[model samples]
Target: MNSVMITGCSSGFGLETARFFFEKGWHVIATMRKPDNSLFPTSDRLSILELDVTDQNSIDRAVREAGPIDVLINNAGIGYMSPFENTSDEIVHKLFDTNTFGTFNMVRAVVPQMRGRKAGTIINLSSSTTLKPLTFMSTYTASKAAVTAYTECLALELAPLGIRTVLIIPGLSPSTSFGKNAGDKISKSGEPADEYKALMEKVQSEFQREMLVQELTKPEDVVNAIWQAVTDSNCPVCLPAGPDAVALSQ
Candidate 1:
């Protein structure tokens, strides 16, 4: 069976994708910051690893133990939703470290082996927030946009070596860990400045109302997109993984 390594498999898209691939009889390495046996069913085809993308030691260790991988999915990332003015430099750096540089670090770890074999697939997870801007999501959008851009350039750089790079952009998924993480980040970043309070409240109200009608992306949308990108040699370099993202992509 072809082996696949995925980051952030503890929840959301990453977890769902891992399960999807496992169901297809692929050897799956589902990694998270903290490995939990209960997260996946017992099988020789499935293995769990601990990985913190921001830490080079962790990334290197996981990749080494994962052995030869046919595909590497950089699905590990953090989200922040706060007014730019209120977003601390520490938070900004944290976002980039995990969202942008984290992807870079993982690619660095896997590419040499892939290039040697002249085969592999790299699937990166990005947010639709990069396609359509939002009021309090500047930092989050910027971080994801960097990944989207990086993946596009990588598609060009790796194609000649027979390695495929795909970008998966999905829309707001309130039911996923992304939403819970965003809220957690907001708490860490603290409240916005008083001057922006009224505007922030209005934006939040509008967003809640919009959510009632919006066709939000589900984890399955991204899971299917990754499957196609891995199985279809002629798949597009960039794929929008949900209704909202598809509309934004156009």
Candidate 2:
């Protein structure tokens, strides 16, 4: 069985993707900031560990414990919704820390082991927003855009070592509570006060509507793409999880 290490398996795509691989007979190492009570049920093939992607020490420890991962899936991320101008410096930094630098640190931890074997695959999870700009999602879009760009460059850099780098872009996956949680996080942040509250709420509601109606890509869609990228000998550098994402990319 292939050995795989997947991050952010507390919920959403990360959780689903980890389950998918485990069911396919792969040994899966699933990491989350809080894993003791994971949403995913206990399984023989699945091992859950605590991992905060923003922390390099956590990344290092998890990578060391997982050992010789055949596939590394960088799926942990956070979202912030507010006007670009209203987005606080801390918020912007947190977004990049988890979505961009987190990915960088994880890849850094695993790539050397992959290089030693000259046989491994790295799959970066990105967003369709990288293709189509969205309002109030400037920081989120920028983070995923950075992931896509980094994946592209890494693909070229790692190609010579027989290790491959790939990206899977998922359109609005409504099955996850990402939007709801993100909105709640911002509202609870106490940043958008008095004058800006109405506008912020409007943008968030509109985004929720779009997610419900036009962008309901499920976790299955992303997991399937991940499987293809990890198992297929000739997966492309970038793969779209749904038709909407494919069209947007074009």
Candidate 3:
């Protein structure tokens, strides 16, 4: 059976995707920062491993343990929201470490095997906020925008090697850790500056309102998009997931 290794399987898209593929009879290597078998249904086809995508040693070890695989899903990322001025260098670095470099490092770890075998699929999860910049989310948007741009370029580079690179743009969803993490980051970063105060408050209000009123990108939408990316030769390189994401793409 074909095997797939996915990062960030603790929750949201990664977790659901892992479950979906395993139910489809694919060997699933579901990885999180800390392994917890209880989060998954018991199955001989499932392999849960601890992985911290920001660390090369952790990635190398996970890749080694995962062995050869037909698919790699780069879904491990963190979200933060703050005015650009309020976003410290350290916070920006952390964002890039987990949201950007983490993805790049994971690709580096798994690409060698995929390149040699000349077959594999690389699916990355990027945010739909990148399509339309948010008032207080410039930093977060930039990080995810980098992923979208990188995947587009990587697709062309990998096609000749018989490997496909696909980008999945997902909009806001309650199931993901984004809201919690972003709120935590902003709390730690302290409140917005006086100049940005009014704008930030208005943005936050609208954001909460949107959550209540808008149809978000569901975990299932992302899982289905990933399935098509891996199984359909004619699927687009960039597939937007959810109602908001699809609408933004067009």
| Candidate number of the best TM-score | 1
**What are the per-residue Cα lDDT tens digits for candidate 2 across 102-192?**
9999999999989999999999999988888877788889999999999999999999998999999998866776654344224334465
Estimate TM-scores for all models. 0.96, 0.90, 0.95
- Candidate 3 wrong stretches, greater than 4 Å: 179-187
Output the number of the lDDT-best candidate.
1
Mind giving the per-residue lDDT tens digits that candidate 3 earns over 1-250?
A: 9999999888888899999999999999999887888998888899999998888999999999999989999998888878888888888887888889999999989999999999999999899999878887888889899999999999999999989999999888877888454443333776766988888788889988999998998899999999999999889999999999999999
lDDT of each: 0.90, 0.84, 0.89
The number of residue pairs in model 3 that clash at the backbone is 0
Ranking by TM-score: 1, 3, 2
lDDT string, candidate 1, 94-133, tens digits = 8898899999999999999999999999999999998889
The Cα RMSD in angstroms, rounded to one decimal, for candidate 1 relative to the true structure is 1.6
The TM-score measured for candidate 3 stands at 0.95
Q: Pairs clashing in candidate 3?
A: none
Colliding pairs, model 1: none
lDDT measured at residue 52 in model 3 versus the true structure, 0 to 100: 88
